[model samples]
Structures are given as structure tokens and as C-alpha cells.
Target: MKYLVMVQGTQLDYEAMRGKASPHSPAWSEQDVQAMYAHMEAINNDLSETGELVDAQGLAEPAKIRTVTLGDDGKAVITDGPYSETKELMAGYWVLECESLERVTEIADRVTRCPQPEGAPNHPVAIRPIQDGAGDLC
Candidate 1:
């Protein structure tokens, strides 16, 4: 089965990125940020070597995102982000072709273990199966 593993970071998580600092440290440090990326790369590498990874990518900050909806007159309405009501912002995603949900969960668990600022909770990793050929994905 093909699965999508989505990473969601909370508002606090995004705020912590303003300056580099280990969540456990008293001061910001670039090393902490580098370590996080390194950890992510390692996970991606492992998946690639195992031939389970289809695609993976991180998203730009939410401030740069835009939301579109239908207006009262049927015209498109646009809003800029920092969508406050959402508990978490989607940070990144990974697509994988795996044999079972168990395998997908294992991948998600590994993602949750990546390093981040102190007191920042693990970003929720949502794993879902991709439906086969029911309609055009595009």
C-alpha cells in the first residue's frame, strides 16, 4: 500500500525556529537547528535505501501560505496565513510505498523522535493510505 506521512508542527514549534537553540538549552544555537535537519536527512536516507520512499519535502513557513475560499457572490476569497484556529500547521510530508500500516506507523514513530526545542511537543505525524486509481489525483 502507498501511504502519506504528514508532519504537523504547533505554533510554538514555529516560533522556536526564530533563533536556533536546543529545546533543552538556555540560549539559541545554530547547532541545534542543524542537528534537526541532519536527523531528518538520516531518516530519509534510510527509507530511500530500503526502497520504500516515494517522495518527501518540507513546506515554507505558514506566513507565506494563502488560503482560498468561495465568496458570497461565488468569487474567490483569499486570506493570508497565520491561520490561528488550527492547532498545528502542516510542516512537511513523506510518501511511502509499504506493505502494511504497521510499517507506516514505524516510520511515523521515528519521525516523532527527531530533535526540537525544549518543551516543544512531538509534532503529530498523521499516516494515511492512498486510494488506488479511484480518480485523478491531479
Candidate 2:
């Protein structure tokens, strides 16, 4: 089965990673950012070697987001964001083809342990199984 493993962060978190310190998060040093990239690379490499990785990507900053809602006239109403700077938004995700939920859970655990600045928030990692088709009833 395929699973989507996601990690979330606030706008403050993104700023911190870019070395901008705010009351909510500390600035990350160049080394701190490098370490995080290396850790994630290692995990991706391992998954690739094991033939379990489908796709992976990191999202752009929250400031560039566009929210679309249905207007009363049934047209798309667009809103620009840096919406609720403290609200958690998806930071990155990995699509993995794994033998079981336990395997993906183990990978998510490793993601949670990725190195970060000393005062960084411990964000939770989420995993959801992908439904291939209607045959996946349940």
C-alpha cells in the first residue's frame, strides 16, 4: 500500500529555518539547516534504495499561498495569505509504498527525530493510507 507521510510547520517555523528569529522560534544557523537537509536526504536515499519511495517534496513558504472558496455566485473567490502565521501548515510530504502501516509509522518516527535547532517545536508527523480505488473499501 501507499502512504502519505506529512510534516507541518507554522510561518514562524519557516522564517526560523531561513535564519530569521521571531518570538515564537529561534533563527536556524546554516549548519542547523544543512543538518536537517542531510538527515532528510539520508532517509530519502534509504527509501529509494529499498524501492519504497514514490515521491517527496517540500512546500514553498506559507506567505505565497492562495486560498480559493466558492462565492455566492458559484465563482472562485481567491484570498492571498500569510494566513494566521502561527497556524500549522504542511511543510513537506513523502509518498511511500510500504508493506504495512507499521513500516510507514517507523519512517514517520525517523522524520520526527530529524535534527533541528535546540528550541524548535516538536511538530507531529502524520500518516494516511492512500486509497488506490473503490476496491479499497475499508
Using TM-score as the measure, the top candidate is 2
Give the 10-residue window scoring lowest on summed lDDT in candidate 2.
Answer: 77-86
TM for candidate 2 is: 0.94
lDDT per residue for candidate 1 within 30-52, as digits (tens), equals: 77678889999999999999999
lDDT by candidate, in order shown: 0.81, 0.93
State the lDDT of candidate 2 residue by residue for 39-110, as single tens digits: 999999999999999999999988888889899999998888855544888899999999999999999999
- Candidate 1's error at 26, in angstroms? 8.0
Each candidate structure's TM-score, on Cα atoms with residue i matched to residue i, is: 0.85, 0.94
**Whole-structure CA lDDT of model 1:** 0.81
Candidate number achieving the greatest lDDT relative to the actual structure: 2
